[model samples]
Target chain A: MFGEELKQFQRLGFRHVLLQVLNFASVIASGLMIWKGLGLITNSESPIVVVLSGSMEPAFYRGDLLFLTNPASEKYKTGDITVYKIPGADIPIVHRVLETHDVVKKKSKRSKTALTGTGEQLLLTKGDNNEVDDIELYQGLDWLERKHIVGKVRGFLPYVGYVTIAMNDFPQLKYALLGGLGLLALVQRE
Target chain B: MHNIFSRVNNVSALFSSCMMGLLVAIALSTLLFTADPKGNLNIASVKVFPMKNRRVSARKQDLAFVNFNITADLRPLFNWNTKQLFLYLEAEYANGQGAKNEVVIWDRIVRRKEDAVINVIGKNKYMFRELSSTFKNVPPAHYALKYNVMPHVGALTYGEAGRTLEAVPFPESRERVS
Candidate 1:
């Protein structure tokens, strides 16, 4: 009995373990590759965003997935919607630029070297359909600089992000799905 | 034979459980930190009123004027510590070209529970005088007005407080359009 069982054990050992490891590695690699590809194509660290609110109703809705692109040398313009992250804040904002002012002041001879720029780009942003500009939202942060922007929204698909929202809202479903899929994968002998 | 099948089933169960545990960890992380996608703020009302205006005749035989208005009744997102707010108002023209009339509206700051408004003043020729800052020298056309209200080191209650009031155009006949 022992001799026969030892031969059968060979069928269950190294090959099965190696196959599982390879499958997991491939999944991880593909995810990284896609993220890198998106970064290169958009010239932005984050190339996609999901609309988190209804501030832009009638134009965009919640759960909509927005595709973003930011060329390295590009400047923003009026009516362009953008996503920007503020320092010390975990969430990013989505809004439209209403106006831009290029302000240049003659530098005084004494402090000329200390100033960051002779001119400052002052930006005014607002949500479409919002009655007021975004001055209140800036929290006295003054003007939003070009460096604060993450990306500009180019296109959007509605309600497609609901699955992400749902999975977050109810975590049990997420675990159940994973468990079911793993079981299915493991049960197949071939 | 039964023992062999039992062992296979045990291995499968263990694999599934481990996968489920990892998935749960990921989901927990997402929930703990990521911003909620369901958040939204509705703008309900808006109103604007000119605060100051000085109408004068230019030496070149053209009319010139400066006006400031205070906009009021902007409902806020929540009852948090508000730091500051910014606003921009521009005069638009129908032809979208150089019409002598100009209205530059900008807000310095807005406080909590306070009405927001921008001050504007400019002068143009009499023909252009009739042209409103709403746009270049065209009547019945409106100016593009936009604003944003952000939090400054403050907190916004998840879904209850940020509903803004809609903008109601000031009645043309009112003495101070607000």
Candidate 2:
């Protein structure tokens, strides 16, 4: 049988518990809705990113939050910083453009591979501080095209994402911190 | 009055102890083995053509090109002794029909500073570039570039702590004004 404490609390105010649960559900649903909305509006799988490393130093530091947007109608250009995903890689990278060539137009009609469609293009990228372009990292990929790009870095907030960086660096700390915060939120009068 | 005063002091002590415990937990976590940001600097260029910005009004017979010019500033971050850097390039198409149509345009060792250009041609193309072993043979409708840079031996900041790598994209020029 349930304890008297549980029954008494339930009888005294089940409405408060219901209201809190509803509030939590509403917050989560709203967050998901916003994410989906961003995906649709930007036409990108990820419309936001956190700068994980100092690879883009000065412009973006570690823990900086970046806002991304990749409109289906917009085209990427040289000097533009973009976030793209590799076929098998889980994480995406942000880098600048290096080179590009329209290969579809290069193959002859009689060639083994001939393009009959339109809007064909390829591109290269490199980091701002490294010595060479990112050819080795491509894992035999020659160039990145429109489909691989996740988004483009449009804006960023510095140091605001330190908490995210900390969480990523120490996953246990993240859970502990969350649990502690929840307890505090529950116990606090205000 | 005495009972009320004692109760208030007890509450205050409880609150202060909770605060202290939280602070200690945070401090302990910071000192624990955390995943620090490694100095493994990786730089590469991925093809970005037919993007929203690339506007080409060329016929099937005309010459269409996607030029990618990438540059990197590896001053303090590059460790000459420890890191062995590798580079690669590839091409793909967006439509699933272009499975048999793919190419590895370039792959090489990056011992010096230079620019790499990888071009893909097809009526429809998508490209990608990566730096890990996972992106070896990608599916259709995508292109990619891959590269690996070794960390230089010895402790040397090619520059500052937060400022190490910088990539510069070559200016897009009109080579084939068809």
Candidate 3:
């Protein structure tokens, strides 16, 4: 197998190998561009996420794919599932909004806005399977602010995201996959 | 080009594209099911009681207890694409400090269509409290039954099933429940 592939590689010439590398790099770049473009359109840092835990079991399972959107004008309401990231926490949590308090901001001297209007929203979330609200998960904060939230979950696809979890669990598998893909791309003709 | 590797690659590529198209079509089909079910939600009573704070044992917080009745025919919301229904009862009110609040006092999950015909007389499962630690000067709250229809492989949809005709005022704080 090695001898045949080596012979074919030499036949393709150095220019063809360079061209293949360029093609692979462009494919990777376009994937990144699409992801960032989706993030910009949805107003979310990560437009898509994979559920790593079973906190939202029965509704969202581990390995499920979630699509998120954070519209600036919309106010999050109770019963809406939101994906929020607490400061100091490494992983973002997906949960339902248990409560929302839209506090009014004090009027400023320079600004002409009224004082009675809604300001930043304070949220409290809870898992569907949990017995109590997620006060302890706040990581010392009293309530979850709009800035802490990544986005509200808009769409879901079951089990499509398990590949990432599997790769994470087994690092060797990830390296093998990347190496195999790279090797295939480099040796393939036309 | 006529090797086994190319044949496998072509077949898999075609299979994945077909799968993508099917998933997209299924996601789009969820938009066509516009089922708005109506129901009745009545707040039987609301009482506030002073209780010891769980996090801060040194201080006491006023906890509001609400008893409500719900009768809603939510079967229409369960379509072929719907996996589960997340039903919740939320209290919408404004505090004396001009803060708008929406709190979910109780919730249930319906996984089957038969269980969607809801009829229940229940009390608040989660603690309902004001940020100020008291319900003092808080205005009357309007209770509503809202639901989220989670699809098996599509967009999540939400709607209100029922709402109280009038806002229910919070009763005076009692030292203890009778």
TM-scores of all predicted structures? 0.48, 0.47, 0.96
What stretches of model 2 exceed 4 Å from their correct place? Answer: A1-12, A104-118, A181-190, B1-178
- Cα deviation at B163, candidate 1, in Å, is 35
Model 3, first chain, TM-score of 0.95
Question: Sort by DockQ, best first: what order?
Answer: 3, 1, 2
lDDT of 3 by residue, B109-156 (tens): 999999999999999998898988889889999999999999999889
Q: CA lDDT, every prediction?
A: 0.51, 0.50, 0.92
lDDT of 2 by residue, B1-178 (tens): 4579569979999997997686445434432322212222222333222222222212211222333333333332223232333443334332223323333334444454332222222221223322211222333233344443322211111111111144323123223333
- DockQ (C-alpha based) per candidate is 0.03, 0.03, 0.81
Candidate 1 docking classification: incorrect
TM-score head-to-head 2 vs 3, winner: 3
Better of 2 and 3 by DockQ: 3
lDDT of 2 by residue, A132-166 (tens): 66767777786788888888776544566788888
Pick the winner on DockQ between candidates 1 and 3.
Answer: 3
Candidate 3 iRMSD, 1 decimal:
1.3
